[model samples]
Target: MSNTAGRIEPAITDIEQLKDHPAMARLLSWKRDAITEAKFDRDELTITIDRAFIRDACNILKPEFNFLSDVTSVDWLPSEPRFQVTYHLLSHKLKERVRLRVMLPGGQPTVESIISVWPAANFFEREIHDLMGIRFIGHPNMTRILMPDDWEGHPLRKDYPVEGYR
Candidate 1:
């Protein structure tokens, strides 16, 4: 798949082929099992880190991928691992970005907080918790950001009623 820049954007899934990538090389050198999957698509790299190692992965990549661009979640209700937490990181020095993801099961999804790595993650993590009900462990204030404190359910959840839960 070629993009507007005429760059060949092949969806490379093999970790071996992607090891040359700086992020991949750094992560692989730390712990191979920390990353479950790797993909290069649309000129971007996405690495799915194991839930237990998300915090460590962030710490390892912090020096180069210094900017924490965004933190968000997606709910895949019917899927066994029904939730995915995504972190977008940017490297101004290298002029590149890499996405890190962690998959969580349906009931009460939770992952360690990255606020220690990037304090900017504070609000982003709060918003995800408020709207998607995914908890960010160790977050100083995990209270609702966009939704009311008494909100019934995570409004952004796929199983959340369309008309709003009564």
Candidate 2:
């Protein structure tokens, strides 16, 4: 591969500009409505998938992103869609990585579980549920993995008390 050793490209946020990206191309071709947003920043591709189509999107991209690197969540407090669940996928054959995200409303932070696509997601999803309070529908076992069964609230949530919950 030819390399421009010193060249640094600017981030691309426009869908048109990212259409040529492998992950973006595949997802857009499969279901345009599934992708809400996309970005290629610092050599990393992040695709924001609509909550309704997250599972489908994962299934579609599974062939290309054959390895699920991680599954995690971010709490965007005071925001209407207060949570972002992110899945990091790796393609060993392509030697590439991509991130898929799903935004969930604060009132009901729920998303379809991708455990069906990648069984390794079991522990990761359970951890997110235990600490962030985001539920994974269809997860074989959704019980807390990091927190106690009787834990009062999700510890990692932005609204959770700084000190231990009383």
Candidate 3:
């Protein structure tokens, strides 16, 4: 399908084809410096971008990947960048799904919200914020969705006790 620039971009069907797609090329071009690593494993293509460039990278992919299926965070405690905020996107026409990840520093634990790109991301962002304590900057309503307002710490964090931190 055609991208916003009106240029015909490759219709990516799988992770292997993604590497050659013009759309993927454009995305890599913009985040070449920000990207620390990328991998296509288990039939999913995952690209990890610096947390600071999350908004820009997501915007580039938004044109082709119209569906934001999920937004979640993985806590890698005892690590420098302790959290990984992942975006799961789908392209109906291409019948492909890919993941975008942004590694947020444990000290700050924040990243730009993609709600603007996909309004449906509002709820998913909230969930990530609530459970992982990863702030989503610019989220219309950045409040706890699955936990009480007075919750002490993010439940999903590795440091959080198994029985709940009391």
Candidate 4:
């Protein structure tokens, strides 16, 4: 395989200035429902979506802030409340990056798809669907992008058992 398969990722610190944008305030005002939390690294802003605000949040970020970079998710199952899906976005124009996280409860852990805002998110959303089982609403092709279609379970989930063999 060729070496250039991944998406373009800019410097993390480049987006340090994005907090000043008014959308951040508007996001915070969504009934205070948006879960804004501190990143482990201490210097980053990780906006956690409440599932309800997922699409609107992404919309405000892309066309407004120009941060249409990448979208993906993580599986934090077995942990209380379940998964933590994340979206990594960067703006070369503004030299800023912002990460959005959405915590899905154990039962129904799905969020709206962002493919309508950013076409590049199509494959990334599929990856999250394939690996974490977090369904993205409105994704044109919400099938598995990395793993096989008939795979038994989402391997990235913490509760998924690891195979003894390679």
List the global CA lDDT of all models.
0.93, 0.91, 0.80, 0.69
Highest lDDT scorer: 1
Q: Give the CA lDDT, 0 to 100, for residue 137 in model 2.
A: 95
lDDT score for residue 151 of model 3: 82
Q: All predictions: root-mean-square deviation over Cα?
A: 3.1, 5.0, 9.6, 8.0
Between prediction 2 and prediction 4, the one with superior TM-score is 2
Task: List model 1 lDDT by residue over 52-103, tens digit each.
Answer: 9999999999999999999999998798899999999999999999999999
Identify the leading candidate in terms of TM-score.
1
On lDDT, the stronger of 2 and 4 is 2
List, residue by residue over 1-166, the lDDT tens digit for candidate 2: 5476676788788999889878898998999988899988888999999999988998998998899999999999998789999999999988999999999999868999989899999999999999999999999899998777997888898888888766
**Per-residue lDDT of candidate 4, residues 83-134 (tens digit):** 7777887766667676788777888677888777778888888887887788
* lDDT string, candidate 3, 19-102, tens digits: 565446767666567666677665567877777787888788877787889999899889977888888888887888878898
Write down the worst ten-residue block by lDDT for model 3. 7-16
How far residue 157's Cα lies from its native spot in candidate 2, in Å, is 0.5
TM-score of 4: 0.74
Candidate 3 lDDT score at position 162: 88
Candidates 2 and 3 compared by lDDT, better number = 2
